[model samples]
Each structure stands twice: as C-alpha cells, then as structure tokens.
Target: MNIAVSIAIPDDEEKQTELSFDELSDRAKEKARDNYRQNYPDDGWWDSSYEDFDKIADMMGICIATKQVPLMNGKNKSVPAIYFSGFWCQGDGACFEGNWYPEKDPLASLTKVMGHAPNDADLHEIAFGLAHLSERCNQLIPEARVKVEHNSRYYHSNSVSYDIDLPMPIHIQEGNELQHMVFDGLRTKLDLDDEAFETEVSDLLRRFMDWMYGLLEEEHEHLTSDEVIDQYLEEMKFDEDGEAIY
Candidate 1:
C-alpha cells in the first residue's frame, strides 16, 4: 500500500523560492484550505469537522506547507494520515491549537484519528513538510521548544523534518555566554521561595531541548504512514513478544 517517491525541491530556477518560514507556512496553510474547498465545495468540515480538525490539526500545532506536489502516482515522504495542507490549518488553528491534546490521558499515549486521512492522501506530504519546518521555527520561538510533545505532532514532525536555515527568536549568538546567562538566571530564580524560579527556568530549558530532540528518532521510531502499514504486516506474522517477530 505504500508507494515510495523521491523528494526534490525543484532545482529548476523557475521554482525556487525565497520566503521566511512563517511566510511559507502561512501560504501553504491557506492554499491547502482553498484547494480543499474547491474539491469539496459543498459539504465541508464546519458542520462537525472539529473532531477531525483536533486529531491532526490541533495535534500538529504549526502552519501548513508552502507548496504541495500534485503527484497522484506516488506515496508521500511521511505518513499520509496527516492533512498538513488543508482547511484544517485555516479552520480555527485547530491544527495549531493548544499543546497538542491537554485533555487526554494515553493508554500509553493515544492520538485518535477519524481514519488515516481523507480521500486526498497527498496532503500528507505537505503536513510532513511542515513538521520538518517546525524545528526551524522553534529557534524563532523559544516557547515552542518548551511545549510538551504529548500532543505536538507538528513539533515532532518538524524535528523529524529535513533541516533548513532558520533564525532564532532571541537574538543571541551561540556561545558559553548564553549558557552562563541561562545558568546564572536559574541559580537565582531557584531561590525564590514561592517555588524556586531558577529551578523552573532550568527545567524549562531542558524541556525545550526535549521538544527539540523528541522529533528525531530512529527510522524505526518515526512512523510514517508507510511504516504503519509495515508495522501491521509485521504484526500479522507474529505477536508483540517477537518470537517469529513478524
């Protein structure tokens, strides 16, 4: 069920782009919604699509892609289950809602879906592309890194996403100076008796790094849709204990 495709940024000079990440993400999200409307013109998600919106949209918590490949013959680079380029992003920011899902407790960490994706699985490429963008966006916004990965599929996707140049939110060059400042601030804040502010700050930095790294897992851990299918097939051959192990 997984059809593989090679990804390219369209080296053709005519297709190259020069835009900020936010600009690209915003454009991608909007274009996706417009395309979805054109295709599904009448019966849309406004009526009861919020549920689906939450699963993928809110879970990702980032903007959409800048462009999408209209390829119908190939599988996407990531899980086709994500609709990174549709109205989901434009609907209500559900795609970038509060920290993924704050209301659910995982049976171990569960993210329910209406199904894998809608009729057009191509958006998965766009969504995956944006996820890849999240890491770059993180440097721009420190809070993004501090946010928990519990529901931020978008964040995870970005870390897993291909690397690109992005500016940091705080204007500070990389050096021991930044670390010293962070350490000093934490040392003092930790003494504020209400609860120790410095400790909190230190933890925040750690959490930020956690968010940064959470996205990068071995290929075995990053479950693209194709991988999911593979997982199912492997499961069919054996049980969880891994004797035959599928």
Candidate 2:
C-alpha cells in the first residue's frame, strides 16, 4: 500500500517573480541600448571615429573649411565643416563642404592609414583619379576653383554637389594654330573637357563619401554589438522581472 501526501507551500510576499533567461537577456539588451543613448546622445559616440575620418580627409588633401566659435575663455575656436548622418535609413551618409586638392602621394598616405597594399587596384584608381583631375585643372583651367558643397536635406553622396567654377580656361590668341593644336592634344590625351572634368570630380567625391559611410557604419556596428552591450550592462543592477533597477 502506498500513501500519497499533499503539502502546501507557504506564500512568500517578499519574493519576486523572476523572468525567463531569454526574457532577462532581452531586457538587458534594452537597458544597454538606453544606457548607450543616455551616455552618448546625438551620436557623440562617433567623436573619436570622426577624428580618424578627419585624418583621412587630410591625407586625401581635402581642406575642410573652418568657422570661428566663441569659447569659455573669450577666445574663438576653429571647427571644420565636416558633416555626417548615420547608419540606417535612406540618404544617410557623410559629406562636407570643402576644397580638394591633389596630394603629392595620396596612395602612400592611404596605405599608411588603411594598410592597403601598394598595388591595390582601387587604391591606384583613386590616386589616379585625383592626379588626373589635378592635371586637367592645371592644364585646361588654371584659375578654376572647385568647391564641394552639401546641398540637399540628406547627407548622402547625391546630396553633395561638386561645383567647378572655371573662371578662366586657357586662352590662346586668334590664329595661334600651333597653340590651339597643342591645347587640343592635351585635352584629348586627358580625355577631360570641362564637362568630363565635372563628371569625374562628382564621381570621386561620391566614392570618398561612400568610403566614409562604410567607416562610420563599421564603427557603429562595433559600438552596438552584443558583446559591447553586454560589457555595458555588467555593472548595472536589475530586478527579478527583467526590469532594470535604479
């Protein structure tokens, strides 16, 4: 004969209900995101990354414009005209209003910062593009001024306009057949007339902006990854039902 016994478990009013492990993990993630936003609002977390970008821009011979800002010490500070928007949604990217000149050795500078191989195809292409454009400017329109301006409400490459003001093209005297022929030959060799030069400049700026967007995206992903978020949540306290405790 077997006896069955039923025992009543006493209710503990002080005890709190614990969430499932998965639920707790999700809550931790939410808390981590909230903490990130509070700590680094308005994408302030990208400051260091932007500094790196500034270095790259300098390497590429991009002279970003600066403005004076009043400081606490009654002095003014200069800030570059770099602008950027972020990781998700359409028309979100990086751009700037600045002047671009050909660097003596942009490939070398890129290699130094990016660790790209010297013979890298894309590297060569970018260097060549800059050099070619500079050459065209020098030969055809010495007094040309190229300004990159961010135009649209968005920050993507399409929103950036490359305005090339060819104030003076090389002028030859009438009936200077020889000089005209030489100029024509140079233009043909470079394959860059005024229109072509504009197109090329637009393409190059867009490429650089794309690269910048990639860098920003990478930085954002690293900052928001699960591992990073977990580290942020390590010191925070949480209550039993997956709610964070103040």
Candidate 3:
C-alpha cells in the first residue's frame, strides 16, 4: 500500500524539458532526486520516476469505493466489499474489478442468527445474494474509497490481490435482512431487547439503500442502455437453481 509512484504531469515548463523514463541520464535522475528532496523534504517519500504517460493517465482516472451490502440469503448476512474502477481514454474505455472478504465463520454466523445451520436452499441464497451484492456495490458506487484497517493488498497464492481499506460506515437499515438477522442474533445471544430496534434498523437500511439507488441512477445516466445491460450481464453470476451466485 505504501508503494507510491509519482506520476505527476509536469507544467508546461517542466514538460518542455521532461526526460523520458527510459532515457533519463544519471544527472537527470540525480536532479529529480534532489528536487524531490528540496520540494517534498518529507519522510516516507519514495523515489520519483515516470511511468508511461498514457498508463499513468489511465491509472490516475481510477476510482475506489467501499460498500456494506446485506446478503439476500443465509439469514441475510452482510459483508464488506471494495472496488476500483474508472474510464480511460488510453486503453480500455472503462475498466473495473474488486474483491470482498466473506464472513470468517458464515455457518456459525448463520447458526447464531437463525438458530440452526442453513439448509442447501438457504446456503444457495446466501451465496447468490453475496455475489449479487458485491457486483451491485461495485457497479453502483464510483470514485468512493472504502475504509480499511490498513492500506495494503490482501495477497493470494495466485498472485492476485486487492487493496484493503478501513471499515465502511455501518448503516442499520429498515426492512433489511442483515439488520434483522444481526439484531435477532444479538438479542438471543445477550438476552437483551430494545423496542426501537426494528425502527432503528429500518431507518439505517432505508437511508443506505436510498443513497445507493441515487448513485446507481446517476451512474446510469452516463451510460447507454447497451452498456448498462452489458455490465449487468458481466457481473451477474447464476447458480444451478437460477439463483445469482457471488
């Protein structure tokens, strides 16, 4: 996450004298270093260098978002999702991808919430909802960064990774499966009851969903019908039972 690279586009003056990344001489590199030191003069500043201008431009266009989406299945669990996406003129018109961290003990979470392990249908629904939520979150949210514990990538054996951010805001929504499940679980686990729990949960869910739908509409206005449909199909994952899978 600390891997910082400077892709600063120089001003007209700097541009006129800019050296290519591949052709920079020892003196130029040294001067860049000294200039960085003099200008930044801060700790944790990594070496500054040029990437391909177009690639740098494309990367600069990237946007990030974090979302908490409730699963439609498995007692309506909620999970965290992160996304990186943007439009670029240099290469692909629009590109995006992201990752989500599933609940560590989903079955246990279900049991705690629902009083029993979910059957096959419940499990299928959960998987479908989680996947659907992730896709929707990525598609619906743009240019927003998710909160994470640290700015680091969660590396996998396949060498693929996603940057993790701090926790996103928690909104207990109205008529939300996640809210009911969580409250019910806590109520039973802790033997506590609050009469306003449902109202509070409903309010949170409503606010979040409304905000998301607004963003979704705004994003929709930017694209053609075909593009929207294409994106939807691309993100949709289906199961054998005609359910969407994550």
Quote each prediction's TM-score: 0.22, 0.71, 0.17
Best by TM-score: 2
Whole-model Cα lDDT of every candidate shown, in order: 0.32, 0.66, 0.32
* Number of the candidate with higher TM-score, 1 or 3: 1
**Candidate 1 global lDDT:** 0.32
User: Count of backbone clashes for each model?
Assistant: 13, 0, 16
Q: Residue 17 of candidate 2: its Cα lDDT? A: 55
* lDDT (tens digit, per residue) of candidate 3 on 1-246: 599788876685462332332244555434433433332323211112111211221222212233344445745422223222222222212212332333233343334323332343433343343333333233322222321222334211122223433222255566698876875665444322233322322232223223323333344344424343334334444322323333
lDDT tens digits by residue: candidate 1, 1-246: 999998766556453333322233444434433333343423322323323333444434422222233445784332212222222332211122123211122111112211355442433443443343343333233233222222444432222221112223354556768765764454344342223422332343233223323222222133323334333333232222221222
For residue 139, model 3's alpha carbon misses the true position, in angstroms, by 38
Model 2: per-residue lDDT, tens digit, 1-246? 999999876787556654432446665557645655555434356667666666656765667776565767999866666677876787688877788765555456555544533554554465466665665556565555678988888887788777677553446766888887877677667765677777877787778777777777887778777677667556555655435564
Leading candidate by lDDT: 2
Instruction: Quote model 3's TM-score.
Output: 0.17
